[model samples]
Target chain A: MMKWIMGGLISVSVIVGIITGNISEVSNAAIDSGTKAAQLSLALLGTMGLWGGLMRIAEKSGLTNVISKLFRPVAKFLFKGISPDSEAFRAISMNITANLLGLGNAATPLGIDAMKKLEKADNPGETASRNMIMLAVLNTASIQILPTTVAALRLAYGSQTPLDILPAVLLTSLCSVCVGITLVFVFDKKGGRT
Target chain B: MRFSDYIIPVFIAGILIYGLIKKVDIFDEFTVGAKENLIAAFDILPALIALMTCVGMLNASGAADMLCSAVSPFLEKIGFPAECAPLAFLRPISGSGALAVYEQIISENGPDSFAGRVASVLLGASETTFYTIAVYFGAVKAKKTRHALPCSLAADLTAFILSALFVRVFFA
Candidate 1:
């Protein structure tokens, strides 16, 4: 789905640019952006590496597991059919904890771990189950506590008070997750599951 | 503020202290964990390049601008700024694309402006919906995503609306 959209958008953009006489700029952007992606990934390396290491320490010290336990009740309520003693439950609990802290880059590895566990537990084949969809919806809605990236960008751009928008961040994320969870249940009840 | 900036560093420092109390080898574990990140980054490189290329092309072609203008009136009618429609549209599809647009908005409107703050909040609150779906499902080799894409996209829309409304109420 994303592949088709990417290809279609690129093809359409090029044709549109040619017709609009923006062909030169389009070609230049293509070249420049190819380099930009690598640079962006490299930039991500430092932050992700630092946080990844910190999270590992946290994980080994059982900090995240404790946080997981704090969220366990919520997880149990959300993940209705999953057992309390299962690894999948713990993994997903940890994943949700990482996401709530606004440690998105640090959360992916954990999120993937949970996805694989959930896949093994509830989905034996190559299709996403309703539970997996619910998890994805919640993760992607983000519900971040810190809004770190936005603050970082604001500081880089010379905002005197980068965190002033924190209130809005909290409100918006809470609303998004509520709406997303509600819709997921509606869809799940419809057996929109694969 | 600097106070907000300290939160992450402080959290990391606390973790380091805890690791010390727990008698864990911080350096070795850090390297092991960072190595995992590096390997994952390398694997994701190709996908990142392809997605970003399309983002660049779309920006250069003026197509994004056209699309924004097309939706701007409807957005304005609903109380969202016309200027922010692009940010809302691109955010769910591509993180880099949305970031580029977001930085531009902040630069143009001043970081304190309603548009700028709303864009900033939206950036922080929402995830790259399609990209996350693709990566998560791909990792588990989930060929049939069923309701995942639609539900996630719906969530993205909800986030955009809530961000715009909240920023208007709180910042404006």
Candidate 2:
């Protein structure tokens, strides 16, 4: 879906550039953006590599287990009826923690694991359960203590204070999470009719 | 050497120490995991390259400028920067797209400028809504999304509105 949209959009833009006699500018942009993407990938490489490795250590050391215990009460409300000691609960907890710390790439595996575990816990129905819906909403609007990726871009762009947007990020994400959870509860009750 | 500068290093140290306490081979494990991470980066390189190329074409084609002018009157009335219109549209669809646009905004306006600050805040606040929905739901094989899409979009909307207001109050 996304690939098609992006491809069509790009084609349209290129055609527009040709019509407007900006083909050279467009060609330059293609080259320039390729370089920027390469640079962005390099920036992501270090941070993502370091965090990925550290998270492996954290996982191996049973840190998430300890944190999972701490996450129990919160998980009860956020994902109620999900047995606290279950695999789904553990995966969900770890996923949420990864998101909170702003390790989104790290969160992906855990989230998919959690979703699979959740699908297993439920009956053999294809429809999404309440827990699945809630997890989707949570992941979609998950709070971030660090906006690492955005900050990386800011730093690459020569921002004097890369983390200066932290407070506003927090404020906006807080609003998003709150609104997201509220809507989830309101809609999930009627079997997502609203 | 601000407080935030210490966070990443501190986090890495904490994990390594904890791994040592757990009797794990920290160096070997880090190398193992980092190698896998590098492979992962390469895996996404194609998509990243394609998306960025599109971002460049769109930007250079004057489409962004056209959209900016199209909304300039309403934007001026609301005291919002017209340059952010493209960002507001692309953010939910693609993370790299918005990031590329943001880098452009800051490069032109300077990072500390009002538009740049708002772009930073807005970028941080939201997720790639369409991408997230498609990925997670696809993972679970949930054919019927059942309000999840609309609800997540509402959240994105909330983030958008708040980002503008919060940026003004905090950065201004």
Candidate 3:
């Protein structure tokens, strides 16, 4: 599946470039993007290290356990089959909390940790579980309480009140998350292979 | 200073204090966790490179622009900013590319303009779905991600539409 997606993307780009007479630009982009990817991964390494460190402290101090307990109702609703006392639950709660705080760096590692836990507890093959799909969808339609990055960009562009769009951001994110969860429920039936 | 500025510092300090009270060997635990996460990051590097290369090629080939223009008319009818068509198309595929386009929009239209506000809300309301899916799925070696892609894109579509609507209601 990953191979097909990657191949499709590459083939489309090349085909389009041929017609558009931008093959040279496409070649350059292919090379540059690889470099960019390496740079991005390097940047993520530092962030992952820092956040992973802090999260470890949180976990050892039972902070994540407390967070998991607080989030049990919501987690149980989203992840029906997963046990609330599991590691996956704790990691998922931590990921959601980090995302809400607009902590992208923290969220990524926690999300990966959650995915690993989910894979371990249930999924034993290459195919994703229903809960795994839900987790990915939830992350994609992330509901952020603070639009910090957008606000910073607005400020850089000289807006008087950068965070003025907060309400709108919140509304849109809510709409997306609701739609995402609804679709997942509709499409991925319970106790069935998805 | 914005209120958000205090969040990270305060949160980090709180974690450190909590760790101390719990008598956790903070540095030892930190390095252990850090090492694990760093390995995870490394594991996903190949996927990231492949996805980004494809995205970069699409952008360079003008395919993204073509699609944006093709969709702009329909978007305008739906009250979506036509200028943000490219952003709506690119946002899911590439985060930094979307940022570059977004910076251009805000600079060209001025951050206070309707398009700028819509773009800001749109950017704030969603994640880079493809990038995130790759990273998370890649970490766990999940090859067959059934329904995740469609579900996420549906969410992105909802976000793109509501971003414009809410921006109008709130600011316009």
The A-chain TM-scores of all the candidates are 0.72, 0.85, 0.65
lDDT of 3 by residue, A91-124 (tens): 8998887777555667889999999999988865
**What is the clash tally of candidate 1?**
0
**Segments in model 2 whose C-alpha atoms lie over 4 Å from true places:** A189-194, B75-79
**B94 in model 3: Cα distance from truth in Å?**
0.8
Interface RMS for model 3: 6.3
Using DockQ as the measure, name the better of candidate 2 and candidate 3.
2
By lDDT: ranked, best first: 3, 2, 1
* lDDT score for residue A174 of model 2: 93
| TM-score per model over all chains | 0.79, 0.88, 0.69
Clashing pairs in 2: none
**What is the TM-score ranking, best to worst?**
2, 1, 3
Give the interface RMSD of each candidate: 3.9, 2.3, 6.3
**Between prediction 1 and prediction 2, which has the larger lDDT?**
2
Query: How well does candidate 3 score on lDDT at residue A45?
Result: 71
Q: All candidates' lDDT scores? A: 0.78, 0.79, 0.81
User: In model 2 chain B, which range of ten residues has the least summed lDDT?
Assistant: B1-10
* Model 1 agreement with the true structure over B1-172: per-residue lDDT tens digits: 5555676678778889999999989999988777766676566667667767776787689886788788887887767776677788778877766766675577668878888888888888889988888778878967888877777777778778887788878765
